[model samples]
Target: MASTLHDVARLAGVSIKTVSNVINDYPHVRPATRERVEQAIAELGYTPNLTARSLRSGRTGAIALAVPELGLSYFAELAASVIEAAEEAGVVVLVEQTGGDRDRELELLRSPRLKMTDGLIFSPLGMGQDDVDRLDVPYPLVVLGERIFDGPADHVTMRNIEAARAATEFLLRTGRRRIAIVGAHEGEVIGSAGLRLRGYREALDAAGVPFDESIIGYTTLWHRSNGARCMRELLDRGAEFDAVFGLNDTLALGAMRVLQEAGLRVPGDVAVVGFDDLDEARYSIPSLTTIDPGREWIAATAVRTLLERIEHPDAEQPARLLLADFRIAERESAGAALDSASAALESAGAILHQGAGADA
Candidate 1:
């Protein structure tokens, strides 16, 4: 009882081959004809027969996306963006969460469920650089996150060190000499915490400010609860800091809540900044000044890169590392001083471009 390709072609006044070309997203299809075919499809409620299409095209018409927890706003938003990009290309996305567990992540890499998809976009949290060999799967794979770099697959990630440094320097330019940090992992040197901490230190050194560890709030996770607890601990210990830099927006928002609970005014008594310019950042009281790490661009690029591999599996190009450019999203929490900093970056020719690193 379902409408077939022939029905769509008849309705659109086109040949079956033209309708097929439009359905397959072939670039050569004329725009007006494609529109007519699409209208016919929408009117008839036609559903694509993916199984038969796969048999003819030698592809599953689907891709898998694996991320560390969807509960985290960052990952959820990233997944949404990936799904949107895939839909634009007429492809389906299968999402999976790994809970950031090393064992689960390893098991997912070999999971038979992936056989139904043509390629994968993987973001691993618990896996480290030492476990890079596990990424050498037979499918077309594109890697995301700061955990494992120089892997066998193409890597797509943000410039953590540079972006974090820009965030710290923004606080310094606001005349906040004593800046506290939230969500730091003690003794870490490679993950997000380590790279962001390195950037913070680099900014302090560049500004001739001495690095003081007493005000640093270390936490095992970057959750809002951990941020609040970390802030409370700093207050209990009497750490004197004029500003707070939460590693992420959720942490910053949590710290801000505690700061107000303790009768401190934001940007009046203490300034605050965070990373991962989440949607909630804009709606928060006084709003949050944070780093926009080009998340949407990263998602789109990851999907496109994976499709390239899927379409040309035998291409001889080496694995590439694509890095996203970041910018400071000026808001009320960090004060008006950000205007000058943004101007400086613009004047210095800080153009947004996704640069490719040396092939690994």
Candidate 2:
């Protein structure tokens, strides 16, 4: 026989209403009481009648997560983290791919399918800041990504400018001057490309390095293919660069591949660095040094915020912009000059010692 809500309430020493509140993830439920109810549910294997509950509560116990493209590694990883966080709250997630088209993103905002979910977490790529008015919808919404700021929703994103500056400064510290950039969009203002480029410029200015426009590679997309294409373009232009910074890891990996394919040895010919610190970044040849932009935290916080919005739809909580802290992951790609020098000395010493012993 299946355990009923009444049985869970008895075991938890709470009213049926309290049990229901906890099951529905109501925010006001006391922490201790919520724990007790959760433990009771675990002990008795109680499952709520979601179909009946939906009819009574008018919530589907699900949320919609929209991203530009799952083909991009960053978005894919972010979606995975979102799914994990949603599961912990005992809710389901429906993911949508917008392909980063402006029309598609705007249409999704007014889609009737949103009624099937409690709320939405949107990461727009094609929409600009001027389209902020489109976000003035009647549903609970949380915005993600570095696009369309000052919108009418709670925004969650990583610190792009600071992190990008850090990455650029790191490359400069490694004895690499005349660094080139991959993934620059033409006339981008507040988008990720522009913000990150701004950070790179800040770092260069701080380091007293002159900014050269010729080394900037332009690309509309941040895909691996785009990275490769940008790198080829830079090469074709005969740009003189000692280092390369890919806006994201996928782009970095693609650029690195092209560099190697063109007979330019990584770290020996030109050092490379990237952002987003995606999982693949660590395993690549001459593992990429990149930024760890609190991605998991962003996903967890976004899910929790959306859940809270659903829990208190009328609460007077002001829309807030939360920035995730970021750090640089040191790896082989950001080659250490001192380490290479030390290695070279040790190798020469070993060779000399072997020759002396053989002569003796």
Cα RMSD, each candidate: 5.2, 10.8
* Prediction 1 global C-alpha lDDT: 0.89
Off by over 4 Å in 1: 1-48, 338-360
lDDT tens string, model 1, 36-123? 9999999999887878788887789899999999999999999999999999998999999999999999999999999889999999
TM-score of candidate 1 versus the correct structure, residues matched by position: 0.84
lDDT of each: 0.89, 0.87
Q: Where in model 2 is the C-alpha error above 4 Å?
A: 1-48, 338-360
Q: State candidate 2's TM-score.
A: 0.82
Q: Tell me the tens digit of each residue's lDDT in model 2 across 252-306.
A: 9999999999999887888898989899999999899788888998999899989
Clashing pairs in 1: none
**What's the C-alpha lDDT at position 55 in model 2?**
79
Error of 1 at 106 (Å): 1.0
